[model samples]
Target: MNHALKERIIAQSKQLGIDKIGFTDASSFEHLKDSLEEQKAAGHTTGFEHPVIEERLYPEKIFDQPQSIISIALAYPTKIKEKPDIVRGERRGSFARASWGVDYHNVLRDRMNKLMAFIKEIAEDEAALTFKPMVDTGELIDVAVAQRAGLGFIGKNGLLITEEFGSYVYLGEIITNIPFEPDTPIENQCGTCTKCIDACPTGALLGDGRMNAQLCLSYQTQTRGMMPEAFRPKIRTVIYGCDICQQVCPFNKGKDAHFHAEMEPDPEVVTPLLKPLLTISNKEFKHKFGYLAGSWRGKKPIQRNAIIALGNARQKSALPDLLKVIEEDPRPDIRATAVWSVGEIVGSKGNPELEAFFNTLLTTTEAPEIIDEINKVIKKLH
Candidate 1:
């Protein structure tokens, strides 16, 4: 084992502001296959995963001659230093803490790239050393890799819970040929605590360090199509990602790390006025939210969720915007959600103008989905 080099890497990691670093052998994650297959067979997976199962299970498949995996974690701030000013009757939606910073993908990749460069600089034969760095978007399951690397234990919420930083840490890894000694894995500490499972609005967490991703609110919000009606009410105010499970975890209580300046949230961006988001231009969304990890699915999902948030809040003041969306939004899904929101706010209080508007919309709209939504809203208004 490269004990001296490993020690140097650990020291370098601290200097690079990596909160925790650990090493593990690059053996195939064979134990995870049955669980993964079970999830896939049960339709529990979000379609966003890397397509091939083999690539996810074997580090050697992706990186040549892999002997070790160097996993790193960087803690992000759980609290925003400044909260956005609240405006009366102006409803806003939130993004989860994971989405609070500049895109964690960019930040982790930058750190890994720097670490790789440093390794090359200090290595006995730089040309012989091979390294493959990956962040969240990578094929390897980050939590599994982090746990094996001894950075943390996988909590019932399906998050890596570090002793010091809790689950508020972002994870990344590099596959290398170096035979570094492995770190000891942390044992699960959840110990009959079901706070996260009991707190889940959708029951996505399966209470065994696994989750039904299809039922997870985080996945539901990112989906571009119409969100299932069952999960709509569960969303509450979050427009992008759900943090309920993380929030309720005992390990996460009052643990906030403001180590990385880039990870500090701009409150206004993370929690923005819902109405503006409903009609925000593509260019404007990119300009405002492009740097955040949550924007990966684009503005349509965010806008759709914003419409849902308006309905969830029962913000009667947003009736005009919701009505405008129903009347003129180009996207059928947005129009459909807006139609639902209108019903949620007005709720059986017959509005002649709204009834007339929907009646007209039912006649004029071409989309079957929007027409169905309009009919439902019309029924509620009566």
Candidate 2:
């Protein structure tokens, strides 16, 4: 490994807007793979993670003969500069910090491409500098690559926490055949602080950087269909993702980076009106929110979560909107959630519209799940 070449690469990375650059050998992530397997056996892994754990553990599976991995992180803004106004009839839902700005996949990919281009220029006619760029959706576990590259330590909340940016950073990696000197990993700093754990509405943050993604509200919110009944109240107004743990971390207390302009959040999109989302058209949903990472699951999951948000808030004003969804929304999941919302919002209030819908629904709807939800809500309300 050439020291001057590493310096040149580091200098080039800074010029390309990469907030942090660290290098490590593309060796097997043995411990991480073992932990992942244990989690999978315990049925704790979110299905959204890479299905093949083998590829995640070994970077060679992605690019054969890999010698080094270049890990990069770009810091995103943690604070909302311009929050939108919510009128009397409106309740707004929140998107997570990661989903605040533009989709990070494209943004990180572009940066990795520039780094690769620079490496190729310097390696011209000499170094065997083939590379593979991986973002969030890529097979390699980004946090593992980042940790190996000395970018940051894995926080208890299952996020990479850099000294410079806390956990408010988007990570990506370029695995290359050319060997670069590896940096020493950053030491873990979450000593005895249970703030993130205590702050978690759901007990997802298991000790030693482990998490039960099943109980994680962040995963729960993203999932389509009915979320587990127990988690409904815990979610509150979070329509897309949860940030409770990150919000409470002492390291993240005041670190709000505005490095990348594209990573800046448009407050309106991040905190949208709950009612409009209940019936947002697909075309319109895409038009306004397609660029965001939170919109990845499409309208159904977000809308389903929105209905629950309304119910959790118990907004009497949202009653009519909830009723409309119960009557007209195509998805049984949405209608089912609305059924619960209608009851939860006006619990035993003696409203004719609600009582009548409940009376009629019990008799007409044959779906056991919907009827069960109706019965449960009715019982709770009474």
Candidate 3:
């Protein structure tokens, strides 16, 4: 491919909502297959088979006769005001800022498709060179490719960080048969900065860039099924994703760090009052949060998160909602969370209603797991 055409593609990518774009020779990622195997051994990459990812690691699989990989970074604005008090209980609902707007995966997919169309138009005469665009969906290790393509360096938080946008950008890539000149990779800038590691409530980030996914709060909250007992209190108020490490990064300092247009939380769900969130009907949950990223886990996890948040907040006002979920929720895990939240709410106050609920649970001849939890809570209360 001509250098001029490559430059034009980069410029067009910026116009298509990508903040940064860089190209790399398709052959540069030869070592990715080995690295992925190492990650698998370390338990960093789960639910992904090596063979599937190996195919994508070799760029030819994405684009036969491929010569270049165009990596693009879309900066998710992080311009919200800090409400430390809200972390305590002064706020209503809470969600990570990145998830406040429309689903980023969807946003990036739409833009990538447009860029591919432009590429096809410009390269129509070149034996119809093929192209494949991918967001976070593919088997590709997007951050590693972006780093090799010189978009940004990986920070201590295990996030790709750009000097201008800190680590608030999402990455996507397009592999094409058209070869383009590659850019030099940027230097690692995280010197002596331990903020992300220090701020992690669950110690997910070790000194090395490697992260323990099992201990990660973000992964914990989004995961379906039962959460481990030890990490429950550490979850804080997060319903979807965790941003404690990002929030404390020195690179993200100052009011200017906030991206005004995209950082603000949705008013309906922003710092949602825990009392109301626990009682949200399934219909209301779908209508309010369906478009947001957090809704992917469905009403159960969010509801379970709400209960946990209420427990952490010690909000007595959330008792009724907790009671309702405890009695009526179809999911056993959700009922279990409600039981825990009610216990927290009634913590020395010991509401008669809650005591009565526990009494009824004790009489029940079914769901031994729930009965055991109820008994545990009652024991704790006494």
TM-score for each of the candidates: 0.98, 0.96, 0.89
Model 3, which residues run further than 4 Å from truth? 28-35, 42-51, 81-91, 124-127, 255-264, 348-353
Rank by TM-score (best first) = 1, 2, 3
Lowest lDDT 10-mer window, candidate 1? 373-382
Which lDDT tens digits does candidate 1 get at residues 1-382? 8898889989999898899999999999989999988999999999898888889999988999999999999999988889899988798899999999899999999889989888888878888999899987898999999999999999999899999999999999999998899999888999999999999998888989989999999999999989988999999989999889989888999999999989989989999999899889999999999999999999999999999999999998898888888878888988898988888888898789878888888788789888888888877776
**How does each model score on lDDT?**
0.91, 0.86, 0.74
- List residue ranges in candidate 2 displaced over 4 A: none
Q: What is the C-alpha RMSD of each candidate to the true structure, in Å?
A: 1.0, 1.5, 3.2
lDDT of 2 by residue, 1-382 (tens): 8668889999999899999999999888977777899999999998998899999888878797998889999999988998798588778888988998889988999999998888788875555568889898988889878987899998878789988899999999988888878899777778888888888877788977888999999899988878888999899998987888888888888899998988899988999888889888999999989999999989889999999999988888988788888777667778888888777787775566556677797897777768888887777666
Give candidate 1 misplaced runs (Cα > 4 Å).
Answer: none
Model 1: pairs clashing at backbone N, Cα or C within 3 Å: none
